[model samples]
Target: MAKLPNGLISFGKNANCTLELCPLEASILQYQPSIPGNGAIIGLFALSMLIHIIQGVRWRSWDFMICMVIGCVDEIIGYVGRIMLHSNPFSFAAFVIQVVCITTAPVFFCSAIYVMLSRTINYLDRSLSHFNPKFFVWFFIPIDIVSLILQAAGGALSATQSGSGNKLGVRISMAGLILQVVTLVIFVALFIDYVVRYVRKSTARPLQSRMKLFLSFLFLSIVFVLVRCIYRIDELRDGYDGPLIRNEPLFMVLEAAMMVIAVFCLNVGHPGIVFDREPRNDAEMSYTYTGNTGAMLQPKLPSSSSE
Candidate 1:
């Protein structure tokens, strides 16, 4: 097989200098990828995507379901790339697919969450929120788009420059992850503030049980994603050859497991639960806040057709 002039490991062909000649330090996949772990994640994401499809169709939640399906599909492809690494650790294609797909998958999930929150605000009293429901969708989705672009670009750079001792790619990826974390924190703060304001200021109106469950699971999913993002920032901060990057088990737990759990949580917290009924027209949907009691009039109940 043809080899590098400087004794560098030759790829796409077998040689005596296979894994033996290449030290673990020089290779990103120091150990063969965990077959069981990667396989399990792939299966989970596939199942999640199927479930999301069924639910989306059943509930007619097209946009939210589309976002969720995209995220799950990305995760599945990423794990399949990991499975490829198990067979050929030196496969550059596998590395690029896993890095780019997995790093940017959460952007879709974030979009779904942002849309749900905006709808939730419209479903509830819009007056309680700091901005209009459309504001959340327009503002945060662009931020998420920016973050996704940065992460994808960084992953591509890192993958192309793998084993070249390049720190620039790592820095770019770190910047993307850092921006994601910051954006999520701000989102959580806004979500919590709106909820608190809604609870404290509104008059006691009978709230649906499904609404309660929806909020609970949505909150849980956000927390899970936030935790995963933080872990990623730490892992990427020291570059690909860092100690944290080498630990396959840690990655399985923090990255794969966290995202799987988060998406499943979204399944449970599907927006359909609260948004099952058709929304009223803008005129009937408007709420008038009463300053005398710090309360707003309740929204009109759904029509029989909606039920």
Candidate 2:
């Protein structure tokens, strides 16, 4: 009876036309459709990100904060893209915005997490770690940049070109995601190895001090980010039309929630908490202990015998 909007098909607009239509996106509900996740909520994520930035600055956790901020910025823009989709799902610009921003955001966050471990290695005891302090920062960060490039480029291609022209984009994005997953897995393993050895060795130290908590915090941060990355890989596995791509609820929890939690974890798991190491003063301490009879001494409270 009524003419539908272009590609509206009860999804919203031509761009939202799905392979399947639900009661929500169906005929009647179209008149009073459910609001998609957008705006205030995205603003909330942005706010969370902003807070992390503040905390990062205050705490001087430069590495951790940068990672969280990048992820949050990606999310804020990604959700804004979704907002665009809600307005006109058929809008190519909106689709491209979301794809490019969201897909590549986590890479920065992961890189940040990787660097935290470098700080942790220093805090724990550099000698025991298999790699040098520079290894963590130099090795993985470049790799992370590579992944970001591939993903951003892929998403750009996919957004601009429709048909099979985008196939390369999809494949490239997949490659980036896969590489990121692998990188994080390797990082997690190395992190665990470092921690295990530290614990075993620490058993010999005085139990009075509890520095292991720093390591524990670092571990939690890693796990949260790793789990979030896994979810993203799955979501992107089948491309945009895939099952996970459309599932908003799962995305909220596994993706958004996990990342927020991970950022906060990094806050708690910061390295400065333990690495407040005082400089070793062998020469000064030795001098103090051996008393330089030739030079100067506190005139030995000269009063004792005379008094």
Candidate 3:
């Protein structure tokens, strides 16, 4: 069997050390417990996601349902990797699991965000907004996809190498997070612009209380996702073995907590509450729980609206 170099794993005299990186056994704390909290935190969020997904599906919030499902699954796998850490902190498989799972999870959130902009465009006066919602999908989503690919490939590449090559993985993941933050900043700004115009317009539809609840949840999801992403960016500042990067408790609060709460937000903000039973000029304006073809909504004065 080949031996690894200092600060390296999975590599020997012949293996590549540039990308494939693994935690060193010397760094493993065999004497002290390497308790990992990510599992519990992520597990709760998965539960939240499951509940919201059921609700979104029932409401036919196809976009929300898909987003919640994918994010939750990714978290579950990442936390499972953390559990493996509790068993053996230096386990290379566990490291990769956590790395890949957590790194790509946000892509799903970005996807849902992209879908939401399109729906909002259809719901309100798109002419009032600064940019077309389609731009978000056409431009930002493709960027997000690219980010996902980079982070995933980087993690895979680093996992195959030995040593602090793990730093390369962190760098790639950080790039993705930074891109997401920039895109989200633009997204929130665009939405806010529409919101202001909608509020000022004389023909604006009155928002129902139920829809408000959904909006609250959705807003919370966005905020939390942003917070988590920022935390990740900060954590990776010094690369993989940086003191800030490996702190498990911080991950529990910022990363896992943010994502779990987001799932709950979907539960309240689901389209079902906003559309079902709300009267509109056209049947198409109503949320079609029964899968009616006429359920398409058009922006107009709300009719006999109930929140």
Candidate 4:
């Protein structure tokens, strides 16, 4: 690899560069991606994906399972890209894989969350919600899809270009992240409002232990994802060569660890654990507390109408 007049190694899809030929600082990331760290992340996401498959099968939660599985796979592939970058940071294929996969992966996860909230509203009391519970699904999922497209497109565009074109890609990706943040903020507000309304209802029963646990972990997962999005927006604001993007520790904590915790929290807060046996008709479902166990008992529907 030959150095340009600026004393930096020339880099591009056509560049023939390797760690042996170029200094680490000359790589786009300015440092080697750690294999050990990324490998551990892959292992964790793989485990979570497996668990999600089993849980989804057992409880018949196909949508949730599919979202989680896809998200985990995306994370795994993205980390594998990082591992490749460890060997040769100038690898354009590796750069594209990590950028696109990791950035868009969370869109699937957010879709899952959006669906769950709708289901939860239906499970609790749809009447208490400001808008139809179905609104979450009909509105948010499409928004997530838009965000996914922008981020993926931006990453691909950025990776394949240089100069001003690269900056344009980063800006587009940043726009996607900003949209996601805005959506989450709106979601949190509606969620809190609904919870407050539900609690204040005269006929409402106190949440059972299982319900409490599920809600707690679900909310925690949302927080983790929100924090990660904010961090990414900041990291990408200055394009690929930004200082925040170069800071591996911040990336590990805010991006990698936050996602790990969020995925696990979803596992713990899985709606199937509580709602699997409940009536599928969100409006007609009724809950009664069993003695001492704090478990919700749903009245069985007639055989002709059973789901």
TM-score of each: 0.85, 0.73, 0.79, 0.89
Q: Which stretches of candidate 3 lie over 4 Å from their true place?
A: 1-25, 28-36, 162-165, 275-307
* RMSD for each of the candidates: 6.2, 9.1, 6.0, 5.5
lDDT of 2 at 64: 65
What tens-digit string does per-residue lDDT give for candidate 3 at 175-222? 878888887887777766777787798776666577567566767777
Could you give candidate 1's per-residue lDDT for residues 1-307 as a string of tens digits?
2334455663323322345556444456577788998998989999889999998988778888889999998888888898987766777778788889999998899888877667776666677888877888888889899889888888888767644534677777778888888888888899889878877864623356777888998989888898888998898877775788789989988898889999999999887776764333345553432221122334555456843
Estimate, for each residue in 1-307, the C-alpha lDDT of model 2 and write its tens digit.
1235553543222344432422333321122211454665576667767777776666566666777787878877887877766654445566677778878887877876677667655543578888886788888999999999988998887666555756677778878878887888898899888777876884323211324665676667667767876787776666555677666677677876776666666566554454433222223321111111111111122234653
Instruction: State the weakest 10-residue window (summed lDDT) of model 1.
Output: 288-297
Q: Which parts of model 1 are misplaced by more than 4 Å?
A: 1-6, 10-17, 20-26, 162-165, 278-307
Best by TM-score: 4
Once fitted onto the true fold, the runs of candidate 4 whose alpha carbons sit more than 4 angstroms away are 1-10, 278-307
Error of 2 at 159 (Å): 2.3
Greater-TM-score candidate between 2 and 3? 3
Give the candidate order by descending TM-score. 4, 1, 3, 2
**Residue 137, model 2: Cα distance from true site in angstroms:** 1.3
Q: Which regions of candidate 2 are displaced past 4 Å?
A: 1-36, 202-213, 275-307
lDDT score for residue 227 of model 1: 85
Score candidate 4 by lDDT: 0.83
Model 4 C-alpha lDDT per residue in residues 54-87, reported as the tens digit of each score: 9998877888899999999999999999999888
lDDT of each: 0.77, 0.64, 0.65, 0.83
